[model samples]
Target: MLQLKLYYHAKPYLPWRFRMATRRFFAKRKRIRYSGSWPIDPPSGAVPDDWRGWPNGADFAFVLSHDVETQIGYNKLDELLEVEKQLGFRSVINFIPEGEYSVSERRIQELIERGFEVGVHGLYHDGKLYNNRATFESRAKRINRYLKQWGATGFRSPLMHHRLDWLHSLDIAYDSSTFDTDPFEPQPDGLGTIFPLWVERKIANPESLTANQENQISDRRSAISGGKSKKPNGYVELPYTLPQDSTLFLLLRESSNAIWKEKTAWIARQGGMVFLNTHPDYMDFKGNGNASSFPISYYADFLQHVKESYGGQYWHATPDRVASYFVGCGDR
Candidate 1:
């Protein structure tokens, strides 16, 4: 039925009706499985045995991210760097290659020199990457190539739009596109909470082009590692555990940083990862050409809170470092 529906939907683009008919004929044939489940392995990477030492021995990590668009001019970047320096925190900035604002190679290199991590934020800021496989793959490859040039190994699909099945093709070390939103989970039983999980792709056929190609992506859904324990995949999935700054400030009509502070404290206590997302276009003092006054003081004060509250124990690192450390790619 699934194949039949796919064929019907694709019929109009084919040159002949027989193409549809042929697909219909084969659609009824179900592939047999020797093993019901694919063989999956626990993450052999260096994951923390316990998450209790972060933020003053509380066992949580705060991953701050910025989605930088073209509209955000250089002035905003300068302000952001100042705020970061004041807080003693470094963040990952995901730059869209084809957006209202483009991040230059020099700027990206500068960020790296300053202990910040650069990441891919899609070729364009359009929200259509997850609509299909072909387009998504092409865009992913382009973004991946650019990231490699910039010395980045992580990705966050635009707007958090993701097709989990297609993510394996990107060749990124880790993905931060998953979230705990109630409406998005595939299975009825949620991943339970907004914790980071491993997303493993199961290659149903070793010989096919897509086989051994990371097809069956699963995370926090079942047991693995000889059934002694259940684990996510080799690819770490750092989900957005809290509302983005845009959602809180604009969508929720919030003018103060109180909401963010409250949520940060809550996630810290849970010993889980606190993934905070913001946009340079929104936070920029010059409005990044978007015309809104930059909230520099508010952002700085927020960072000050984290610095004072967490003290030196908080791992003030970038998202790339977090991903690398989680996957055992970098030194802890």
Candidate 2:
């Protein structure tokens, strides 16, 4: 954790090119070490024990999501949205509530109006939210406020740092902060399952409400007063099954999206979720900047592949819908 703090704290001081080169060097070593489990971990293909398959009899589920980290990334949302819209896909757009840029309510409403789900990425993109229990509890209040203001129920923490048990404080339907298998993140622990898992909220004392609970009491008096509200039903943990774009393009320096296609096929064969989390920050629509961006066509081509290769065989839903369905499916 201390190492993570130092890395994120010093991130601004380090040159972007230096960080990219350093990460690439370490990623090369990790690729060789975790070749068997990464990208397509055969062990992670096992379906949940009580799985009843996707709704509408679809063979598998596909979800798309993005974590906008900076102003540059936020500016590219329109372009990215157009690409997905043209491909007949929509995704959750998570924005940092108090990051380097300011997101207006108008933009949030526009995204919600366009069939894209809005979610709180984090208060800030820094890696300090989980430094300790007290810090998380404090920040969870602010995160919940943004969730309510944006009318969103999904969240994905910056840099994928997470503590699922502690996230119960936030008023979220699901969290995409974990992945099935990725040894490249600061917190590289994988849940080892491709399916969404139920994380029941902890029973809290009415007399001793946590920061988030106290903040929501006005809007949810009955639930907090007697602890009978369905909000306590807990949130879903949606771990991205596909390798991230930055991981493939920047760190590993892949020229194409073959790994995404290969892993999508494998997950589909296993009847698991083909959940993908990309970043608008790393997508190069201009077809340049290899240091931090990949050709946008790589993502476009992958979407087309999914549509053409397995048309009508997969259920494409947003992360929030997936969480609601999982909870409403009577599986819990």
Candidate 3:
């Protein structure tokens, strides 16, 4: 009621007031000056050039990331994995470390053996990482160590929740948490398209921390440093670009494969990365009793459509591979 009242009251003066306010805001802000430090001269050991180019033909890449949590049982994961295998696609599964749905080391190893990438999700799936820098850094380190132990090199933050500025501390080779579209589009500086962008890491000074906090510090600074420090090297960010499976099935109440196929085709023509994200917890047929059945059939059918439509032209790369390619490997 209060919001409605506020909206109604503001409607009268919105046209003039909103325009003037916007103009004043922009007019008062200083223009961002580039220091000629950007573009950083691509690295020597970057991934294969012409990575994005499907010289043979127009190729489509579908890198699936499954956010597996305790709420999603092992049986559901097995079923999802079966569907992926049927589609001939190896997906990257982001596993939580210490949550209800956390996977054991044995299970992680099994995923690795199965040609799937096991990326770090987080210690807990809570949305607390962005609460502050210190907490985020500590949690990142713990997650990184686990990934290292599991022989994984990719990461996707819990809930796709992130503060890109704070990601530099994580030692992972690539991060898959950036998004192209949201409830509204995300506005990141410089990189305008809904494509992968190399997250420029900044070197942190030891002197910046107190004695107690020094040991816990690592160099992952947020990508939004805005010239606060010199950029670090190697790490790349691959953002998820598309409606997540849960979003399609639950939020939009879409249970058809046609919508996904249409969306994928549209994104493919743009010649950019398209990340297909599905959660194991939501793919079950009857475990949760939330929906009528898991959307597994729809997902499998969607993959079949992609394969039939694109043929073998699409690059079947993992999240890490996608990141590496974006850095330089697959340059045109």
List the RMSD of every prediction in angstroms: 13.1, 3.4, 11.7
Clashes of each: 7, 0, 17
Question: What C-alpha lDDT do the candidate models reach, one value each?
Answer: 0.59, 0.86, 0.61
Misplaced by over 4 Å in model 1 are: 1-58, 73-75, 182-192, 206-234, 284-294, 329-332
Give the Cα-based TM-score of candidate 1 against the true structure.
Answer: 0.69
User: Could you arrange the candidates by TM-score from highest to lowest?
Assistant: 2, 3, 1
Per-residue lDDT, model 2, residue 295, is: 93
lDDT tens digits, residue span 277-312, model 3? 877777756445454245567787878887787886
What digit string (tens of lDDT, one per residue) describes model 2 on residues 53-154? 899999999999999999999899899999999999999999999988898999999988999999899898878899899989999989988988998888
Q: State how far residue 154 of model 1 sits from its true place (Å).
A: 1.3
lDDT of 1 by residue, 164-191 (tens): 6687766565678766542222211223
Best by TM-score: 2
